[model samples]
Target: MRNATIKDVAKHSGVSLKTVSRVINREPSVRTETRERVERSIAALHYQPDPSARSLRSTHSYAIGLVYDNPNAHYVISMQEGVLAACRERGFGLQIHPCDSSAEGLAEEIIRVSRSARLAGLVLAPPMSEQPALIACLKAADIPLVRILAASEDPADGSTCVYVNDRRAAYAVTEHLIQLGHTRIAFLWGDPHHGSSSERFMGYADALKAYGVPLNRKLVLSGQYSFDDGFRRARKLLAVKEAPTAIFGSNDEIAAGVLAAARSTGLDVPWDLSIAGFEDNPFSKQAWPALTTARQSTSEIGQHAALRLMDLLRQNRDGHTDSSVANESFVPELVVRGSTAPPRSASPRAEAPAGDTDSID
Candidate 1:
């Protein structure tokens, strides 16, 4: 069967092509009676507007862009799904753009991308979203966007952004371990460049402090956001003369690495050493003993950001309301799994270190 088009809807409704366009776009100027008539005809004809075609025919494109810079494939995919979902709801198309956040002239590059794509607006994900300088530059150019950032609260005043409370979630993860009678907890860090790594670290620190557990700088290790990095760090931490009773990987990948390291070194999880992580990735959950971690709804946050951007675009196009950015906040929920438990009654140290982590300085 031939697919119905905008022209077919206009002809069926006895309306001009322009009128049909206005109706499809949901313009405020369209009278209710005419809109209903056009809608009925659209339904009867089973007509669907080709966003790509309409975009080419007009200055305002029917598609938006999703910009991100991250190494984790799972994280990237979740965010893309969320943004794509919102685009479908508004009858818009999506363009995924992955770029290096550290590149020179980044602000200019993004503005150029939006212009070249003829995008209606943009939805930005970290670490680009966390860059204040880049954000300022884009805002100066008046590009419509919604940003997703790792922050405990609004990172700016009079700005529109979606913030994920990584700090809070990290705190909860650490607290869970602490409550399990594990005072000698080791903290692992992902990339120090990303704000989320620091936010998660702060939460871990807060939990230790609140519970009167003395901070042991030697127990803190730094590494990238990867399984290999986690495994390497875990090996080093475990080899120490006096290792942590519990280990907290900043993310699930790291936590999974820690789990592997523990088993390889003949350490019994939850009994000899407790291990926990953040970001409940699927693989982490499917591990031999499911990981206890915080559930970060990456897709939901991305979806919400795109939805807000859509609203911003509408308000701007209609000139009906202020287009000031809305600052939104979200927090991850804690999910306790099989990986954590109370510490052992006695400290059974791993083999003395071949490479010392006695002092992390």
Candidate 2:
């Protein structure tokens, strides 16, 4: 037998199709007796609404797409969890898609997906979040888009955003090390193409200047955001005539690499050398001495970004195109752990020390 239709249910219940719809949607205006009668008929007939037809009629979908090209597994996992939570709470669904960050057809692929899939909006992850063409393409498609951890240069088109002040967070971490008496600190940089790379490096430099330490060109090592990258860079930095007293990795993965490098080279953490990192990833705790890093609210930021994108979609559907809701950022919190401390000795000529004894005054 064919599926029962709303018309059949209404006819069987001796009510109008509109009444059945009201009952199906649980509209408060329907009387209890009428609602009960409609529900009973609906159950008897096994009537169901076509979601696709409804979506087409309404011209709105409760589904959003998440796009990213980042390789950080921790960040990817946390972001999905956060977005999933919001979707559950709001009665929505998510579709995850990975983009090509440097491919020639990147913009075309994003634009085609946005239009073809009929997505309500998109949540962009870095370094795609910082791509100008991709952003423009999404905007041209007239879909709401939220960029996570995007730089200030991207235009704010009233789309929702969740970001961290990477520069400020980096500065704070470096300052923490500086106050602990680590004058010669080394920086393991993120991908130079990424927006966070520069922001974080600037923060490190800013802290060195504030503490009246000379900016040492030899101490700054540029590396990608990965364990292997950090490992190789750390080895190079440590090979110099006089190595740094501390090393700051762009993220926890890099920090883990640095920690590994330190161990293999016989440099004890926060004893012979200090280390710190950004983005308090799970790897931070697994290291020999837990890493002291900046805590960026990855999950919470993802949740907020999803909610904001939903709001933007609602507004756009209502014929309002206010572009003021775009452009947002989050300030990361500092989590001091066992990985960082004052230099082995405050005096440059003194022998290596032990543990994180000197607090940041």
Candidate 3:
């Protein structure tokens, strides 16, 4: 049988085509009894509306665009699933487009896609969301955009964002290590260009200060958001004369690198050194000893971001609810595992860098 149309539903329900349109679009003002009758006819006939025609008539396409660039497969997958769930609930469609802003011609690629596609709104996940030029191009296109995992510096009032308090979470994670009596904790920072990198560093510094641990610039290292990047940074930290008893990575990938470096150096995890990672990725478990980490709710963050974007699309304005944005800044749950313990009294047996082992007193 041919696909059911609006005309067929109207005839079967004994309602006008306009009334059928109202029922399908879920527009208010239709009588409850009539609406139910039209809905029943639609169900029976299996009527499907053409999104293109609907857009032409109402000038509103029930579609959102998702733009993201990140190497972590787990983070990308969770974000997609969460956004798709929200889209299904709101009777909307999603158009996924990927571009690496770090690559040449990235801005042009994004502009081409956005201008050609019919999008009511867009959602972005970093490192694409953190790209200043990409954000500018989207704004120039005059589309509403929501940024996920964005930094506080990325113009909050201009573009909507769903973010965590990175500073607070980092501080909490650091304090946990300090409380375990690990005075010499090495720090591995993520890509400095992204907003999360600096915020997390501040949190780490605040925690150390609060606990009266002497700040050591030598212990802090910066790296990109890849496992390889983590590996290099961890090596540098391990090579220090008096290596830290604990290492805090910017994210799980980096922390895993620390684990590998420690293993190669013949250090027993927790007994000789403690380790903590961010984002709580699955690889944390596969390490020699399970990793201690902060659990960032990837799926929930995606869902919340999409829901807020839908609200903006409907209202045609940034949401007036401060509580909505405030509520979105989630605190990651700290999961302590086998990777951490009180520091050993005797120094590590590994081949540590030669130095005086200067005390900070």
Question: TM-score winner among the candidates?
Answer: 1
What is the Cα-based TM-score of model 2? 0.80
CA shift at 172, candidate 1, in angstroms? 0.8
lDDT of predicted model 2 = 0.79
lDDT of each: 0.84, 0.79, 0.77
**Alpha-carbon lDDT of model 3:** 0.77
lDDT tens readout by residue for model 3, 197-220: 877888788777766677899999
1 or 2: which has the higher TM-score? Answer: 1
Candidate 2: residue 96 lDDT (0-100): 88
Model 1 TM-score, all chains together? 0.86
Tell me the spans in candidate 1 whose CA falls farther than 4 Å from its real position: 7-48, 346-361
Ranking by TM-score: 1, 2, 3
Question: Where does candidate 1 have its weakest 10-residue lDDT segment?
Answer: 352-361
Q: With candidate 2 superimposed using the best TM-score fit, by how many Å does residue 265's alpha carbon deviate from the native? A: 0.7
Which of the two candidates, 2 or 3, achieves a greater TM-score against the reference?
A: 2
Q: State residue 341's C-alpha deviation in candidate 2, in Å.
A: 1.6
Q: Clash number for every model?
A: 2, 3, 0
